[model samples]
Target: MALTYTLDNARSLIAVALIIFISWLLSENKKRFPFFLTIGAIAVQAGLVLLLFAIPNSQAVLSGVTAAVDGLADASDRGAQFVFGYLGGGQSPFATVPEGGQLPFIFGFRVLPLILVISGLSALLWHWNILKWITRLFGLLFEKTMGLGGASALAVAANIFMGMVESPIVIRAYLDRLSRSEIFLMMVVGLATVAGSTMVAYAVILGPVLPNAAGHVLVASIISAPAGILLARIMIPEERKATELDYEVTLKYENSMDAITRGVQDGVMVAVNVAAFIIVFVAFVGIVNNLLGLAPPLNGEPVTLQSLFGYVFAPVAYIIGIPWEEAHAGGNILGVKLFLTEFIAYIDLGNIPADAMSERTRMILTYAICGFANVASVGIMTGGMTVLMPERRSEILNLAWKALIPGFMATLMTAAIVAALPAQLFGG
Candidate 1:
């Protein structure tokens, strides 16, 4: 057993090494990159993954927290049921069976409302200063260990709880003082992690397939914070003469009532935006797939855009610990995820046959798709930052693509770290 475990770990390490090499190879100023900082970041990521996956006690605690979050999903469903009645949370009204079985996979009905509940909770927590304190602690730790400084670290830390859109507000007052590298780091971190409000929604989506769905998503976002910053620095090696530094976090809520109200309003917009985006994006994908379908069919199946993506990214899936035979399927998921959105990719995942993917492949893909690293996020980041610091609009536009490369790479590194762990983390 020990020998088998060691060999599996060796394979995982090779894959991780590949990911790092690929990251370095893409470095803009390779000579200027602080290699030691990159190494330390990877080491920290690996250690944290072990603490979350290999250690029974810590993993159990995370699993318990996931269960609690899962329960929140259940509670949200009940609330939806109360409002939308049968269509709300009542077993996905889009069944395609002769007997009309409950599909339970409608995005608008099942996933949108979750944004409202968790968003409110996050707001209440922030109003109570719990989130601020936690971000401060993590920011200081990142400053001391990763040299990310206070403001950049705090914004990244806030990405853990808030959505990418709201996190930059934490460091809004210091935007002008930030260096170009710091801006890229902030954008990548945002693009690389999802908000707490939607984490529950994604958790609800993946829960049926992954028991520790919330736990895994949480771990992916947290680890990707450091990984994202590290890769950003590597790709666009910090060019500032001195350093971008800010330690003050002066933002505060007016009151608990105000927080709850604002939180709900923001969440409603998010839910509506998500619903429309998913609807439109899914339709667009179908249109593109149809256009690609005009190509010759292969193996009795039409050659669609998804198949083309699979062909390009299959090698990536294989190296990341997916079984070889299933690599094509995993590759398609990665493409749809990066090109479209994880929301749709996860919907694709839910439909794939369980026998087609091994538990290991499933676990790796789960973490990989946990982030907001799709093409849409690039525009979102560009627009958001342009609004926050219009003076740096030129800089934000130029590095948007640069930040995106590492945004996805950070999640890949997270998946690689998870790949090294035992299958028990995936749960039964």
Candidate 2:
């Protein structure tokens, strides 16, 4: 049976409040007796969730977002086909294939071409200043509404345009001046967010396997942003005197050509890192599975690391509204996302036995696992921050562990919101 509205709202409210309380307890100012501050934070977080549901137009709002996401997917696909010609998975470039016959191509031949096309188009958009304008608008909204610093607000907003490290470059000049708490918030936000450029690729990869996959992924990221800020602030309250927030939109490049070139170069590096991380992490998981398989009853069986993760995380999956039958499978993907990257997790989700999971379970899991907050990303974030501000490298390193908790919490909060929504609203 579905949960009653009162029960659903109560559960969600308690979840948000608990997150704020936990954040305060874990932060450095335990001796400060920050009860009033904690209460206010919890109130704000709960109020946001309630506001989303309280509106009579809430369903329309979600539908509009879903439609916009689908439009972006359609446009991105068309752009991909134009840049890569037939290689981007359209009709044959030079020769036509027989009506029923399949094209002779390898994985890299098909997928890598799409990645290149998206990367190039992203560069072109940035060069035209389209992406910058969008970032600035979002930055202004976040800064004015959320009461965040200019640099942190801009970096978080730019996340929709670029990768974690790349977004930080938007406010590179202000990194050294940010307070320890603010720096921690920046890291948490970076970890919790996903880049827009990769959204196209992910949509293409999972669209075939899951309905509205692209739309859900976009919603997941957007919903996670506010939660990321709330959790990060709770973990480390703003301590230093507030500076005047600025909303300047500028791209650090010599020319349009240089911007495109640099953008593509950055994209290539991202793709390579993604590929390398997946290969190594999958192998490591295999090793662990092999050891686990050696147990007498499990020997020579198909038991894998995923199975273990499934068993370990199944309870939490159920708490997020996954059906009992599919919770274990959803749990496995969640585990992979946390330990490895979302790239591998999405691939695993696409291949998981359909009979083992319902469509609703799959959609919620996709939303839940759509962030850059994996264990591997921590090292990437730390190394990137070190280069950006050598003096604050120690501070970045110190806050790394705390940041991971809020980052993960942000994604979980998104999952909870989606889970609490009526399933029929998004075609679940």
Candidate 3:
């Protein structure tokens, strides 16, 4: 028992050390690595993972809270049904699919509209100041624990429930005022975390296949937030001590009706953008794969982009504690998420053959791929922030790719933390 515990701890520590070492290697000011801050950040992330999955009392409470994420998906379905009708919203008029027949989820109808409902609800929550209050509570934690500037902490906390670009909107006033490191940290944090509004769609797709998938996704977002801050600081140390900025809260609706209207409007735009991106990007991948397929066979099969990505990222998979043999499979998902986005990655994961990934590898990936980390996120975040603070657009562009470094680092760090835990902890 003691030996097993020692080995687990050693592997986990090594994973973290490797991540920090590599991040430090890329630091702009290599001499200024924030050792204590890095340690504190990792400790906090590890503690949160433990509380959610290892401690009985904390796990029970968190399970109840995260279970509500799944409930939100159900509620969104009811709303989706009202607008799109039964088949469109994915509620079959008949109770079951005919044997060997299909009721596969339709993305346009079933998955896309959940973003709308969540946006409207989010707008109303903002109007009521509920989200601000919630964000402030978390903001305080990061501020104290990580000694981050006020605006930076607030943005990171908001990333827990908001999308990458949307989380920074709350700090728009301070956007221009923030130091370079602070702005970069905010961007990376945004890319590193998934929005609450989008989690509903993810839950619907993954819930049936993975046990308590929503809960795990929720935990992944939470743990990734601090990791973003920590890695951001190490990779690009903040030169100036943070001064508390007067937070100007802007995400409010004039009234109940206004909230709903704005929410739906925002949701519509988001859904449209999402659909368009998926349509174009998926087609792009298909075209690219076909082109790659023309190449000579590797092993017994033609070389596809997906397999290439898997082989490329296989080492990262191994570092994150996936078993040696399964690392290639795990790398494929990690690569997909990094190259494309978690949306496509989750879709691939949901549709994989039963034997594609071991149960333990599946668990690690359910956490790893829960973020907005992708190559495109840099552009999305840069464009979004440029609109809010055009004066700093150049700086935003400069740090765009830099943001991806810690953005992915944060999420992958979370995956490694989970990978280090005993299989028994997750009921393997």
* Selected candidate, larger lDDT, 1 vs 2: 1
Backbone clashes for every candidate come to: 0, 0, 0
> TM-scores across all candidates?
0.92, 0.82, 0.92
The sequence of per-residue lDDT tens digits that candidate 2 reaches over residues 94-209 is 54576533354323444444455556666667677787777777677667667776777777777755767787777776776778877787788787878766665566566666
The TM-score of candidate 2 is 0.82
Which candidate gets the maximum lDDT versus the true structure? Answer: 3
Q: Write the per-residue lDDT of candidate 1 for residues 10-99, one digit (tens) a residue.
A: 566687777667777988777786778877888788777777766667768877978898788888888888898766656545556334
**How far does residue 146 in candidate 2 sit from its true spot (Å)?**
1.8
Tens-place lDDT digits, model 3, residues 309-350: 888998888778887798888888898889887888888888
Clashing pairs in 3: none
CA-lDDT, candidates in order: 0.78, 0.69, 0.80
Deviation (Å) of 388 in candidate 2 = 1.3
Better of 2 and 3 by TM-score: 3
Model 1 vs truth, CA RMSD? 2.7
| Residue 294's lDDT in candidate 3 | 89
